[model samples]
Target: MNWRMTRYTYWMVLAVLSFGPEAAGATWHVDDSNTSAPWTGADWDNPFQYLQDALDAATAGDTIKVAQGTYHPDDATQNHTEGDRSETFLMQSGVVIQGGYIGYDNESPPPDTRDWELY
Candidate 1:
């Protein structure tokens, strides 16, 4: 192949790699205090009320940011059908669920700041 063609191919590969699915992961928010129903879980203000909701929507390479609160699988609205006590949160491969985030507050917009000790 010509040097120019080889260089063009390398740039094309780099562009694809930079914008691939693995490089374009999504971030989902989960907050127990969210009174708003039918939230998209796309941002902190309008977050998924249930942890399971975010989990259900998350795919590979996605990140689920959960607020600091108690979340039980039995209270799941999406994953658990019968609200069985034996139900549990299923951890997906390549998906990171990070907790200790201060979710929506009536006073101010929730911060992206995360501190496990001081939520």
Candidate 2:
């Protein structure tokens, strides 16, 4: 309504647009190691490499497209520890992961300890 309020709203809008979908911080990409032009490249073209990279750089609302490979955590722990857990792959507050999502149990090598969550 007022010029001040309008200006604040404008700035807020700009911020949201620039940073993106609020908690949008997920990264998507294949995690295979065999889809490169040279083939000799170090997973350069392999979706797996890119996928892993994205996961590493993801924040929130991001989605990682895992091709077809084993996704094992470093610790193999059964805990999300949301909020600020490094290896948790929280996918932020509003992130989504695509591809290779075999659910909580399918994620691991069966007999899962119940660690991942699929929203």
Highest lDDT scorer: 1
Please give each candidate's TM-score: 0.75, 0.35
Write candidate 2's Cα lDDT for 9-105 as tens digits. Answer: 9999998899875543434454444344332212223234333345555556666545544554432223433233355343345546665433222
What lDDT tens digits, residue by residue, belong to model 1 across residues 1-119? 69999999999999999987746799999988887676889998789988888888899989999887888876666547655778887767888999988886634434577878977
Query: What number of clashing residue pairs does each candidate have, in the order they appear?
Result: 0, 12
Displacement of residue 94 (Cα, Å) in model 2 is: 1.8
Residue 55 shift from truth in candidate 1, angstroms: 0.9
Give the distance in Å from residue 107's predicted Cα in candidate 2 to where it truly belongs. Answer: 26
How much lDDT does each candidate structure score?
Answer: 0.82, 0.44
Question: In candidate 1, which residue ranges exceed 4 Å CA deviation?
Answer: 1-22, 79-83, 106-109
